[model samples]
Target: MIDQLSLTNFKAFRSADIPLAPVTLLTGLNSSGKSSVLQAFVLLRQSYDSSTLFSSGGGLLLNGELVELGTGLDVLHEDVVHTPGLPTPLISIGLRTSEGQNFNWSALYAAEQDVLTLHSASDAQRTKSVFDRRRFQYLKADRIAPATSYPKSHHQAIGLGFLGASGEHTVNYLRHHARRPLTSKPLRHPKAQTNNFLDHVVAWMQELCPGVNLEATEIPGIDAVRLSYGFDGTAGLTSSARRRPTNVGFGLTYALPIVVACLSAGPGSLILLENPEAHLHPRGQSRMATLMAAAAAAGAQLIVETHSDHVLNGLRLAVKNGAMSATDTAVHYFRRRGLQAEIVTPRIHEDGSLSDWPEGFFDEWENSLEQLLD
Candidate 1:
């Protein structure tokens, strides 16, 4: 797990050290640099995957499988200070892992170039960073919507265990690894019919929508897999009548990858999720946070970017319930200051209380309530 991430002249941050934990939540108003924090990790992960970071003359791959950050001009901080002797300001990304390994990658800024040349010598012999590990998942804000069938990629889903940046490979992964054994007891759902991975997935997904069971199967003779849902009772749809993902509500299809990713997480796995509460109701949003907390407790590292206070409260609830220690969680509130981003981190006490409540930190509920009362 990465203990801290340092950014210099990268995106909205001129210089900042973002503290990380087993579970770190990045929350703030839109456009306040929350996504940028997750992008940094994906940038490195994609760059390494493309072999550009480890090659002899590797640089940052601006567009890749994980992220498609534009040229250096678009990513460089707007108010980056140019040194007197240096022709170009260097954008650096540093990471300190929990094992105390420090990895720094600095690139020379090129206004129009997508791939920025590394300022330091490229060395592939160094130990692997958590980002380079195979057990990683990055789900972007814009994910796959309701579809008849999702593409099946054996190399991506089975070979790498990646659900894709947009979670497009999730169905394929589910079809391939459905029966795999779960490694952690905390992640197991008591109501699950079996201890297999698929049942556990169905059980937790019921939290989002009760009695919802799903199936993932390969669409023969094609590079696609199908997903369908069945409800338990004689309600909208019965268990005998399986409905395609297109017929199912958008929320279930939208939240499926998230639930699968959390269930699949284990020790040394790094999961980065953006807006895990996209289409779910308030209670379901909070339950998603519980899933994330359970993932952390099971030894995976999760860095989540969310705007829902319900998700925040759910994490607090998880802590209060002793699912995870307060020390394992870090909450960051990002706000814009001039042309750069500033972060205010509030500590979580053992009782699930926060060390401080900054003005704009999930205070909208209180603000609206006060207005209503007045």
Candidate 2:
């Protein structure tokens, strides 16, 4: 897992080094650079996946499947700080591993070009463990909504075991790997019908909506799969009439990939989630946090971006409940200072209490109460 991420003259950061943990939570207000941090991971993943980063004449591809960060002018820090000894001002991204290996990439700035040429060391010699691995998932915030059918990509769903950046291939993945055994004990759902992947997925989805069961079936002669949900009592009473995603509320399908991503996690996997709590209720959001912690305990490294306070409290609850060690979790509260983004990290104790609560850091409830009382 990445121990730290350093940004030099990157978007919204002149120079910043953010510490990472087994489970890292990035929370802050709008446009405070939280998404930018996650974008860096996707950027690297995109470069590596396209085989450009590993080639001799390789560089950063600004537009790719994982992320579409525009030209150099858009990504270059507004007020760039140059290295004292370097002749040119360049954009550098450095990733340091827990085992003390460093991977640094520096790109020359072009005003309107999408691809930034590399000015740094050989990408072949650098450690590409996290970005190059197959067990990686990056779910974007603007994910797929309620749809009648989702596309099926054999290479992505079967060969790569990828659920897609927007989880567009999730139904196909489920249809193919439903019966696969869940090896991770912590991620297994006790109430699940079997030890199979699909069963565990249904059991966890039931947490969001009670008695809810789902199935993914391949459409005949089509490169697509369909998802259908049915309640327990309704299945027996109404001759097993299933409900499409459009009929059910938005939360279940929206959160499906998150559940699958967490369940699929294992040792050496890296999962990056953007707004995992989107379209879910407060309780569902909290449950998502617990699942994230459980994934960490099961040996996967998760980096989550969320704005929900319930998610924060649920992480604290997980630490207190012994699901994961407090020391293994890191919470970063981001806020904009002038033109740059500054981060303030609050420590979590064994008791699930925070060392400090900065202003605008999930304190809206207390602030509103104070106003009402006054």
Candidate 3:
């Protein structure tokens, strides 16, 4: 699990060190640097797993160039100069495990020289060190390609593969997992919950979309497995409603990856998500938040960027319901100025309420009042 992340000359941040928790929520106004935080993780994951990061054409584009590293901080555009005399841009990330193990890595760019360098605590003492940017996996929202029909041979093999940031392959991932049965005794979290991770996920999804039953099936001629969600209906209902994956709504399709990722993630895996609440109604968004908190409680660390208060409230409800401990979650708010962004930590209460509601924190009523008064 990641415990800290520090950014220097990375996008809207000149220098900032942000702490993390099992489940971390990033919320802010438009252009307030919420996306930058998610982008930083994508870049870090690309440094480790380039193939997955660049699988889709919509992946990261630095200054219109597809260069992976040492491409400079121009990736994060700014209108003002920071530190007047600084010569390079830097981005560093720190990760810690439950056992207190720590890993520190950084990337540096010199715009004038058009050179970039990757650094890490493992090589801090050396003058020059070789950097290998293939140790992590990344997914970005824009890079997610919808699953589509193609030649049966074109189907990708499944194992421990990557899911894009937008959760494009969520349905596929869940379908793959549903076919495999427990090889060992069902794994349980510290809290001794009766259901395993995958069971809990399916339960939550059922709660969100009632009358739907998910299962995995193998095509007669195709080697690939497919996930199907059957809708409980009368025999006279349309064929689509009686089918599997085809019968489910798009919201369930979009939410599948998040559920699969959390259930499949191991102790050390790092999951980065941007607005996991997209495309869902307020109730569904809240349910998604609860699932995320449950994932964190089960031991997978999550870093999420969201603007929905419904998602936030859902997490609080999870805490209040004892699904997750308050100490295991944290909320960070970002506010952008001309060139820099400010990060604030909000206090979460036992009742799952926020201690301080910042100005404009989902204040649509205030905007309406101003219009009425004027």
Off by over 4 Å in 3: 50-73, 76-91, 94-102, 110-115, 119-157, 165-172, 179-201, 220-225, 234-248, 369-374
RMSD (CA, Å), each prediction: 1.3, 1.6, 6.3
TM per candidate:
0.97, 0.97, 0.75
Off by over 4 Å in 1: 234-236
- Over 1-374, each residue of candidate 2 has an lDDT whose tens digit, in order, gives 78899998999899999999999999999999999999888888888888777677688888999899999999989999987787657888888888888888888888798888888843574555656467899999988788999998999988998899998888898999899999999999889999999999999988887788899999999888999988878546331778899988789988999999999888888999999999999999999998899899898889999999999999999999999999999999999999999999999999999999999899889989999999
Q: lDDT of all predictions, in order shown? A: 0.90, 0.89, 0.59
102 Cα displacement, candidate 3 (Å):
5.1
**lDDT tens digits by residue: candidate 1, 290-309:** 99999998888999999998
Candidate ordering by TM-score (highest first): 1, 2, 3
Residues 239-281, model 3: lDDT tens digits: 2654544444467766666666666655545677777776678
The clash count for each model shown is 0, 0, 8
lDDT (C-alpha) at residue 181 in model 3: 44
